[model samples]
Target: MKSEFYCWLANKLPRGLAYWCAIRVMSHAACANPAQEVDTLTPAQCLKAWPK
Candidate 1:
Protein backbone atom coordinates (compact mmCIF):
# COMPACT_ATOMS: atom_id res chain seq x y z
CA MET A 1 0.00 0.00 0.00
CA LYS A 2 1.09 3.55 -0.60
CA SER A 3 1.99 5.75 2.41
CA GLU A 4 1.49 9.16 0.83
CA PHE A 5 -1.36 9.94 3.22
CA TYR A 6 0.53 8.76 6.27
CA CYS A 7 3.59 10.80 5.39
CA TRP A 8 1.47 13.88 4.87
CA LEU A 9 -0.38 13.33 8.16
CA ALA A 10 2.77 12.46 10.13
CA ASN A 11 4.53 15.58 8.96
CA LYS A 12 1.60 17.72 10.14
CA LEU A 13 1.41 16.03 13.57
CA PRO A 14 3.89 16.76 16.35
CA ARG A 15 6.81 14.30 16.64
CA GLY A 16 6.13 10.91 18.29
CA LEU A 17 2.34 11.39 18.34
CA ALA A 18 2.25 10.29 14.69
CA TYR A 19 3.91 6.96 15.54
CA TRP A 20 1.50 6.47 18.42
CA CYS A 21 -1.50 6.97 16.15
CA ALA A 22 0.08 4.90 13.37
CA ILE A 23 0.62 1.87 15.61
CA ARG A 24 -3.00 1.83 16.75
CA VAL A 25 -4.24 2.23 13.18
CA MET A 26 -1.96 -0.52 11.79
CA SER A 27 -2.60 -2.98 14.65
CA HIS A 28 -6.36 -2.98 14.44
CA ALA A 29 -8.56 -4.35 11.66
CA ALA A 30 -11.72 -2.69 10.35
CA CYS A 31 -14.01 -5.17 12.10
CA ALA A 32 -12.13 -5.16 15.40
CA ASN A 33 -12.84 -1.93 17.21
CA PRO A 34 -11.21 -1.08 20.51
CA ALA A 35 -13.13 0.59 23.32
CA GLN A 36 -12.25 4.28 23.14
CA GLU A 37 -14.26 5.53 26.11
CA VAL A 38 -14.25 3.72 29.47
CA ASP A 39 -16.19 4.40 32.65
CA THR A 40 -13.85 4.64 35.63
CA LEU A 41 -13.81 6.39 38.99
CA THR A 42 -11.32 8.96 40.15
CA PRO A 43 -11.01 10.18 43.77
CA ALA A 44 -12.70 13.50 42.97
CA GLN A 45 -15.48 11.93 40.94
CA CYS A 46 -16.00 9.24 43.57
CA LEU A 47 -16.35 11.86 46.27
CA LYS A 48 -18.80 13.87 44.19
CA ALA A 49 -20.82 10.80 43.26
CA TRP A 50 -21.10 9.50 46.81
CA PRO A 51 -20.60 12.38 49.14
CA LYS A 52 -20.96 11.85 52.90
Candidate 2:
Protein backbone atom coordinates (compact mmCIF):
# COMPACT_ATOMS: atom_id res chain seq x y z
CA MET A 1 0.00 0.00 0.00
CA LYS A 2 1.10 3.61 -0.56
CA SER A 3 2.47 5.77 2.25
CA GLU A 4 -0.27 8.27 1.52
CA PHE A 5 -2.89 5.63 2.13
CA TYR A 6 -1.20 4.61 5.34
CA CYS A 7 -1.02 8.23 6.39
CA TRP A 8 -4.71 8.67 5.68
CA LEU A 9 -5.65 5.58 7.67
CA ALA A 10 -3.40 6.65 10.53
CA ASN A 11 -5.09 10.02 10.64
CA LYS A 12 -8.60 8.52 10.46
CA LEU A 13 -7.87 6.63 13.66
CA PRO A 14 -8.28 8.47 16.93
CA ARG A 15 -5.30 10.80 17.45
CA GLY A 16 -2.18 9.68 19.43
CA LEU A 17 -1.85 6.07 20.66
CA ALA A 18 -4.95 5.05 18.70
CA TYR A 19 -2.96 5.40 15.46
CA TRP A 20 -0.58 2.62 16.43
CA CYS A 21 -3.51 0.66 17.81
CA ALA A 22 -5.27 0.93 14.46
CA ILE A 23 -2.19 -0.46 12.66
CA ARG A 24 -2.09 -3.37 15.07
CA VAL A 25 -5.80 -3.98 14.62
CA MET A 26 -5.47 -3.92 10.83
CA SER A 27 -2.47 -6.25 10.93
CA HIS A 28 -4.37 -8.68 13.13
CA ALA A 29 -7.38 -8.63 10.79
CA ALA A 30 -5.09 -9.29 7.82
CA CYS A 31 -3.28 -12.10 9.63
CA ALA A 32 -6.56 -13.73 10.58
CA ASN A 33 -7.81 -13.53 6.99
CA PRO A 34 -4.81 -14.57 4.92
CA ALA A 35 -5.58 -15.15 1.21
CA GLN A 36 -6.89 -18.59 0.27
CA GLU A 37 -8.69 -20.44 -2.51
CA VAL A 38 -12.26 -19.18 -2.78
CA ASP A 39 -13.45 -22.35 -4.49
CA THR A 40 -12.19 -24.64 -1.73
CA LEU A 41 -14.91 -23.61 0.70
CA THR A 42 -17.84 -23.95 -1.73
CA PRO A 43 -19.77 -21.01 -3.20
CA ALA A 44 -22.40 -20.22 -0.54
CA GLN A 45 -19.88 -20.81 2.28
CA CYS A 46 -17.06 -18.88 0.63
CA LEU A 47 -18.72 -15.50 1.06
CA LYS A 48 -18.76 -15.79 4.83
CA ALA A 49 -15.26 -17.27 4.95
CA TRP A 50 -13.44 -14.58 3.00
CA PRO A 51 -12.84 -11.00 4.09
CA LYS A 52 -14.62 -8.21 2.23
Candidate 3:
Protein backbone atom coordinates (compact mmCIF):
# COMPACT_ATOMS: atom_id res chain seq x y z
CA MET A 1 0.00 0.00 0.00
CA LYS A 2 2.59 2.53 1.11
CA SER A 3 5.08 1.16 -1.37
CA GLU A 4 2.56 1.60 -4.15
CA PHE A 5 2.06 5.20 -3.18
CA TYR A 6 5.79 5.75 -2.92
CA CYS A 7 6.41 4.24 -6.32
CA TRP A 8 3.66 6.31 -7.85
CA LEU A 9 5.03 9.41 -6.22
CA ALA A 10 8.58 8.59 -7.23
CA ASN A 11 7.47 8.03 -10.82
CA LYS A 12 5.91 11.47 -10.86
CA LEU A 13 9.07 13.11 -9.49
CA PRO A 14 12.27 13.94 -11.36
CA ARG A 15 14.83 11.11 -11.47
CA GLY A 16 17.29 12.62 -9.01
CA LEU A 17 14.51 13.70 -6.68
CA ALA A 18 12.95 10.27 -6.85
CA TYR A 19 16.22 8.59 -5.92
CA TRP A 20 16.71 11.00 -3.03
CA CYS A 21 13.15 10.49 -1.86
CA ALA A 22 13.51 6.73 -1.98
CA ILE A 23 16.73 6.86 -0.01
CA ARG A 24 15.25 9.14 2.62
CA VAL A 25 12.10 7.08 2.93
CA MET A 26 14.06 3.86 3.19
CA SER A 27 16.41 5.36 5.73
CA HIS A 28 13.54 6.50 7.92
CA ALA A 29 11.74 3.21 7.57
CA ALA A 30 14.91 1.32 8.41
CA CYS A 31 15.42 3.25 11.64
CA ALA A 32 11.83 3.34 12.86
CA ASN A 33 10.36 0.54 14.88
CA PRO A 34 7.70 -1.54 13.11
CA ALA A 35 4.14 -0.42 13.65
CA GLN A 36 2.41 -2.84 11.31
CA GLU A 37 3.43 -6.31 10.23
CA VAL A 38 4.95 -4.96 7.06
CA ASP A 39 6.81 -2.20 8.90
CA THR A 40 9.10 -4.73 10.55
CA LEU A 41 11.00 -5.18 7.29
CA THR A 42 14.64 -4.23 6.78
CA PRO A 43 15.42 -1.83 3.93
CA ALA A 44 16.68 -4.67 1.75
CA GLN A 45 13.62 -6.75 2.55
CA CYS A 46 11.36 -3.85 1.78
CA LEU A 47 13.08 -3.30 -1.55
CA LYS A 48 12.68 -6.94 -2.43
CA ALA A 49 9.03 -6.97 -1.46
CA TRP A 50 8.29 -3.74 -3.30
CA PRO A 51 6.32 -4.09 -6.52
CA LYS A 52 8.38 -4.09 -9.67
Candidate 4:
Protein backbone atom coordinates (compact mmCIF):
# COMPACT_ATOMS: atom_id res chain seq x y z
CA MET A 1 0.00 0.00 0.00
CA LYS A 2 2.83 2.36 0.82
CA SER A 3 4.48 1.39 -2.42
CA GLU A 4 1.27 2.03 -4.32
CA PHE A 5 0.86 5.43 -2.69
CA TYR A 6 4.40 6.46 -3.61
CA CYS A 7 3.92 5.19 -7.15
CA TRP A 8 0.76 7.26 -7.35
CA LEU A 9 2.46 10.36 -5.95
CA ALA A 10 5.56 9.92 -8.11
CA ASN A 11 3.34 9.97 -11.17
CA LYS A 12 1.60 13.11 -9.94
CA LEU A 13 4.33 15.24 -8.34
CA PRO A 14 7.62 16.73 -9.43
CA ARG A 15 10.77 14.88 -8.34
CA GLY A 16 11.82 17.58 -5.91
CA LEU A 17 8.51 17.40 -4.07
CA ALA A 18 7.49 13.84 -4.78
CA TYR A 19 9.29 12.15 -1.86
CA TRP A 20 8.13 14.56 0.82
CA CYS A 21 4.60 14.64 -0.50
CA ALA A 22 4.56 10.87 -0.83
CA ILE A 23 5.67 10.44 2.77
CA ARG A 24 3.06 12.86 4.09
CA VAL A 25 0.32 11.56 1.83
CA MET A 26 1.10 7.95 2.60
CA SER A 27 1.06 8.61 6.36
CA HIS A 28 -2.30 10.32 6.13
CA ALA A 29 -3.70 7.64 3.84
CA ALA A 30 -2.51 4.81 6.10
CA CYS A 31 -4.17 6.38 9.11
CA ALA A 32 -7.41 6.64 7.20
CA ASN A 33 -7.66 3.18 5.64
CA PRO A 34 -10.67 1.43 7.27
CA ALA A 35 -9.02 -1.97 7.34
CA GLN A 36 -6.23 -0.54 9.47
CA GLU A 37 -8.58 0.75 12.21
CA VAL A 38 -6.89 4.05 13.03
CA ASP A 39 -8.63 4.48 16.40
CA THR A 40 -7.49 1.15 17.82
CA LEU A 41 -3.95 1.57 16.60
CA THR A 42 -1.12 1.77 19.11
CA PRO A 43 2.39 3.20 18.68
CA ALA A 44 3.36 -0.25 17.50
CA GLN A 45 0.52 -0.07 15.01
CA CYS A 46 1.91 3.19 13.76
CA LEU A 47 5.31 1.59 13.30
CA LYS A 48 3.78 -1.29 11.43
CA ALA A 49 1.40 0.75 9.32
CA TRP A 50 4.23 2.82 7.86
CA PRO A 51 7.52 1.44 8.92
CA LYS A 52 10.87 2.79 7.88
Candidate 5:
Protein backbone atom coordinates (compact mmCIF):
# COMPACT_ATOMS: atom_id res chain seq x y z
CA MET A 1 0.00 0.00 0.00
CA LYS A 2 2.77 2.41 0.86
CA SER A 3 4.65 1.62 -2.32
CA GLU A 4 1.52 2.07 -4.37
CA PHE A 5 0.86 5.41 -2.72
CA TYR A 6 4.38 6.60 -3.34
CA CYS A 7 4.22 5.49 -6.95
CA TRP A 8 1.00 7.39 -7.41
CA LEU A 9 2.67 10.46 -5.97
CA ALA A 10 5.72 10.02 -8.14
CA ASN A 11 3.47 9.98 -11.19
CA LYS A 12 2.70 13.58 -10.34
CA LEU A 13 6.37 14.49 -10.74
CA PRO A 14 8.32 15.10 -13.94
CA ARG A 15 9.48 11.84 -15.51
CA GLY A 16 13.09 13.05 -15.86
CA LEU A 17 13.24 14.27 -12.27
CA ALA A 18 11.70 11.07 -10.97
CA TYR A 19 14.11 8.91 -12.90
CA TRP A 20 17.09 10.98 -11.75
CA CYS A 21 15.98 10.76 -8.15
CA ALA A 22 15.52 7.02 -8.39
CA ILE A 23 19.03 6.63 -9.77
CA ARG A 24 20.50 8.77 -7.01
CA VAL A 25 18.69 6.82 -4.30
CA MET A 26 19.78 3.51 -5.79
CA SER A 27 23.36 4.73 -6.01
CA HIS A 28 23.23 5.78 -2.37
CA ALA A 29 21.97 2.36 -1.39
CA ALA A 30 24.74 0.74 -3.38
CA CYS A 31 27.27 2.78 -1.37
CA ALA A 32 25.92 1.34 1.88
CA ASN A 33 27.98 -1.30 3.74
CA PRO A 34 28.33 -4.36 1.56
CA ALA A 35 28.35 -6.65 4.61
CA GLN A 36 24.92 -5.43 5.67
CA GLU A 37 21.93 -7.49 4.59
CA VAL A 38 18.76 -5.84 3.38
CA ASP A 39 15.71 -7.53 4.94
CA THR A 40 13.66 -6.57 1.88
CA LEU A 41 14.17 -5.37 -1.67
CA THR A 42 15.21 -1.72 -1.86
CA PRO A 43 13.04 1.02 -3.30
CA ALA A 44 15.17 0.94 -6.40
CA GLN A 45 14.17 -2.66 -6.97
CA CYS A 46 10.53 -1.78 -6.55
CA LEU A 47 10.87 1.14 -8.92
CA LYS A 48 12.28 -1.21 -11.52
CA ALA A 49 8.93 -3.00 -11.57
CA TRP A 50 7.26 0.17 -12.76
CA PRO A 51 6.94 0.90 -16.46
CA LYS A 52 9.03 3.79 -17.68
Candidate 6:
Protein backbone atom coordinates (compact mmCIF):
# COMPACT_ATOMS: atom_id res chain seq x y z
CA MET A 1 0.00 0.00 0.00
CA LYS A 2 2.68 2.47 1.01
CA SER A 3 4.92 1.29 -1.84
CA GLU A 4 2.04 1.81 -4.30
CA PHE A 5 1.61 5.41 -3.15
CA TYR A 6 5.37 5.98 -3.36
CA CYS A 7 5.52 4.53 -6.87
CA TRP A 8 2.58 6.67 -7.98
CA LEU A 9 4.12 9.81 -6.49
CA ALA A 10 7.54 9.02 -7.95
CA ASN A 11 6.07 8.42 -11.41
CA LYS A 12 4.41 11.84 -11.24
CA LEU A 13 7.81 13.41 -10.62
CA PRO A 14 10.65 13.92 -13.09
CA ARG A 15 13.03 10.94 -13.13
CA GLY A 16 16.04 12.74 -11.64
CA LEU A 17 13.90 14.54 -9.06
CA ALA A 18 12.32 11.25 -8.00
CA TYR A 19 15.78 9.70 -7.47
CA TRP A 20 16.99 12.75 -5.52
CA CYS A 21 13.87 12.69 -3.35
CA ALA A 22 14.38 9.01 -2.57
CA ILE A 23 17.99 9.62 -1.54
CA ARG A 24 17.01 12.54 0.68
CA VAL A 25 14.26 10.48 2.34
CA MET A 26 16.67 7.61 2.98
CA SER A 27 19.31 9.97 4.40
CA HIS A 28 16.76 11.54 6.72
CA ALA A 29 15.60 8.11 7.89
CA ALA A 30 19.19 7.00 8.61
CA CYS A 31 19.82 10.18 10.60
CA ALA A 32 16.57 9.79 12.54
CA ASN A 33 17.47 6.21 13.48
CA PRO A 34 21.05 6.67 14.59
CA ALA A 35 20.82 3.96 17.23
CA GLN A 36 19.89 1.34 14.65
CA GLU A 37 22.63 -1.19 14.12
CA VAL A 38 23.98 -1.00 10.58
CA ASP A 39 26.78 -3.43 9.82
CA THR A 40 27.67 -1.71 6.58
CA LEU A 41 31.23 -2.55 5.55
CA THR A 42 33.64 -1.48 2.87
CA PRO A 43 35.08 -4.07 0.47
CA ALA A 44 38.33 -4.20 2.43
CA GLN A 45 36.49 -4.73 5.69
CA CYS A 46 34.39 -7.48 4.20
CA LEU A 47 37.49 -9.26 2.93
CA LYS A 48 39.22 -8.94 6.30
CA ALA A 49 36.24 -10.56 8.04
CA TRP A 50 35.86 -13.34 5.50
CA PRO A 51 36.60 -16.87 6.73
CA LYS A 52 39.83 -18.50 5.62
Residue 13 CA error for candidate 6 (Å)? 1.2
Against the true structure, candidate 3 reaches a TM-score of 0.41
Pairs of colliding residues, candidate 6: none
Residue 11 in model 5: shift from native, Å?
0.9
Tens digits of per-residue lDDT for model 5 on 1-52? 9999988998899989988987766655555634544445477664564446
Best by lDDT: 5
Scanning candidate 6 in windows of ten residues, the lowest lDDT window is 37-46
Better candidate by lDDT, 4 or 6:
4
lDDT, candidate 1, 1-52, per-residue tens: 3689867866899878877764444444221323322233333433343324
Q: Report the poorest 10 consecutive residues by lDDT, candidate 1.
A: 29-38
**Reference-based lDDT, residue 48, model 4:** 57
Order of quality (lDDT): 5, 3, 4, 6, 2, 1
lDDT, model 2, position 40: 42
Estimate, for each residue in 7-50, the C-alpha lDDT of model 2 and write its tens digit: 89767876768766645555555555567442343334433444
Query: In terms of TM-score, which candidate is stronger, 3 or 4?
Result: 3
Question: What is the TM-score of candidate 1?
Answer: 0.33
- Judging by TM-score against the true structure, name the best candidate: 5
Q: What are the RMSDs of all candidates, in order?
A: 15.7, 10.2, 8.2, 9.0, 8.1, 11.6
Point out where model 3 deviates above 4 Å.
1-9, 34-52
Candidate 5, superposed: residue stretches over 4 Å from native: 1-5, 34-52
The parts of candidate 1 lying over 4 Å away from their true place are 1-9, 30-52
Candidate 6 per-residue lDDT, tens place, 1-52, comes to 9999977887899989878865555555455456643344333443343445
Output the better candidate (2/6) by TM-score: 6
lDDT tens digits by residue: candidate 4, 1-52? 9999967867987777866755565576566566775455565555555645
Ranking by TM-score: 5, 6, 3, 2, 1, 4
- TM-scores of the models, in the order given: 0.33, 0.38, 0.41, 0.33, 0.49, 0.47
Model 1 clash pairs are none
Task: Please write out the lDDT profile of model 3 over residues 1-52, one tens digit for every residue.
Answer: 9999977876788888878867766655554535635456666765654446
**Candidate 6: segments with Cα more than 4 A from true spot:** 1-9, 37-52
